[model samples]
Target: MLGKAWQFARRHKTKIAAVSAITGGLVLAGKLAESKFKQWQEEETRKMLEQIKKQHHYENTEKTSNETLKSLFPALIKTIEKSLDSEPILERIKNQTGNKIELWNELKVLSFARALAMIITGTQLVLLLKLQLNILSGILYIKQPSQVLSSRLQERFMALSQNFISFSVPKICEQIREKMIQLLALSLKEKFTITQLEAFFQTTLLQLDLPGFQKLIIAPDGDHISQPLNPDEHLLLDDLINNIVELLEHEDYAKIFRIGLQTSLSNVFDYLAESYLSHESYKENGLRSEVRLPVAKLIPILNQSITVYQSVLHALIKHYTIREYSANIYESFCQAPPDAIAKPSLSTLWPF
Candidate 1:
């Protein structure tokens, strides 16, 4: 059967070749046509995209110019009003200069002058808007100039507010401290002797159990100086009490008290100075300098406040420690000493 089929195929070989050639040609033509259609579609899409981009650019330019005109309109109106009023000044000048210019002639001249000024002002506004629009669209890809301008204005306003706050907080803190000192003095009827106050502060610091109280210097990172006391540590409590008592015994205790407090106050003053000076310099020079205005003003104030807050907490702890230690010592010492008593129990011997 295979031999007979091969013989029949060979007998119609010419006809088979004709059909195969026609089918292959049709397939090749179809592929070429499809390729051309695809290229045409891509070219059409590109043209459409270019057209859309051009239209968008035109609209942006138009919108930018319109906004510029709107912003300038009020100022332009005011200028015109001022120029019209200046007719009197111009006439007075003419009279004073002995130019023999009539008031009515001057009025007509001022009217023409005001109109010309308005036209010139309008043209200038349009030109400025055009330039800004071109710059934003070409360089910055900003579709709306007004939005960009508004954002810039808002940022400047915020910076100004931050600068004000940074400078004012230190003065405010100083005033509060003064008031507190006065109140403390008033509450204590008896004059606080330097020695007695020193004792009081020493006792307080001992009771607070705060770390880094004896260290006069603060670290730049602030974290090392501001850590809180460990409540579970009995040794910390004893050291805190001992230091407070020692401090109280010092003759110049008032001057040297609250080491952390002094560090904090110094930090605050330094910060305020840095912030104010930077703000002033920024106004004088500009923001284009090596020292960024925000950095110069913001960093100092933030770091100062953080250190100050830590110092304040440490000072409070010291105050409480002193008071508690004083109370305990007074209670224990109210009676005879353990050695003086005939037979003291272990509990009575260590009145901790």
Candidate 2:
């Protein structure tokens, strides 16, 4: 029976070959199409993941996470509190200024502002990235394989030929080849500004000198002030301090920083203290009284400023670490599904 069936198939070689070719072509095409579709899907998934990772890295540091935050917060708060020991300085500022109400009021405002800024900024940074991740996931997962293939084939084959016969086997195959190229190009160029912004902020933060608080401020000029040991000293200090400010103001960095300021009081105080301390003349005065002016009475201001600065720095580090962990969570969402749907099939040319 099998031999007779083989002979019958052989006798109708042209028809058999055509049918075989069609069958084989469909199977091969289906597999190839499936593979290509899967590849495209995976590539899209990978790209989205990379974007999420980039955004994560940018908006939040590697250190930001609940576990890390939990571990670090107590220690950080303790350190800041210890450094701030406001009692001695508060008394000094009150005695020297004789305007206790005004001075304390200003310190109170500054402290409050600082805390508010850090909380807000940190929250905004984390939330902004989270929203971006959600948007990206929706875009990546919403696509259907059949729809994509149909759309692609239509755009390619429709433009080439109108009639069925003109759409020869080889020609149709050629069209698929062309469509694949177009699809690849489109996928590669897809925009993700959130990722870009995140990357910018992360890179900028990495470049900042977090511990060099004293170097940021320059001392007021005086005959007693010591000259720079080297010719490059002034330039070095200027570059370092300028770099920090520059990083803070960068489009992406500024956006995250502003958001972070809104989330945490520490962040706001950090910004204020850093900005004020970076001035060249402030360090020169050394929070002391001058014969020409009673600015010496403002020593409490300097002390309070330092305390706020320390507190903000500690808080930022803690918050940053937590954000880093959150970014990792966003990254896990990028993996491709295992049981994806089947690809579309092409109808064959047959006589009615």
Maximum-TM-score candidate: 1
Candidate 2 at 221: error in angstroms? Answer: 20
TM-score, model 1 to reference:
0.33
Whole-model Cα lDDT of every candidate shown, in order: 0.37, 0.38
- Residue-level lDDT of model 1, residues 1-352, one tens digit each, is 9999999899999999999999999999999999999999999999899667755755564455455445545554454444344446454655675443343334333332333233222332232233233323332232242422234332332222122223322233233233323333222123233234334334433443222222211111222223333343334233323333343343333322343243333433343444444555556765423233332223223322332333332332234432333223222232323222111121332122
| CA lDDT, candidate 2, residue 69 | 39
TM-score of each prediction:
0.33, 0.28
Runs of candidate 2 with Cα error greater than 4 angstroms are 1-13, 37-61, 64-246, 255-352
Each candidate's number of clashing pairs is 11, 36
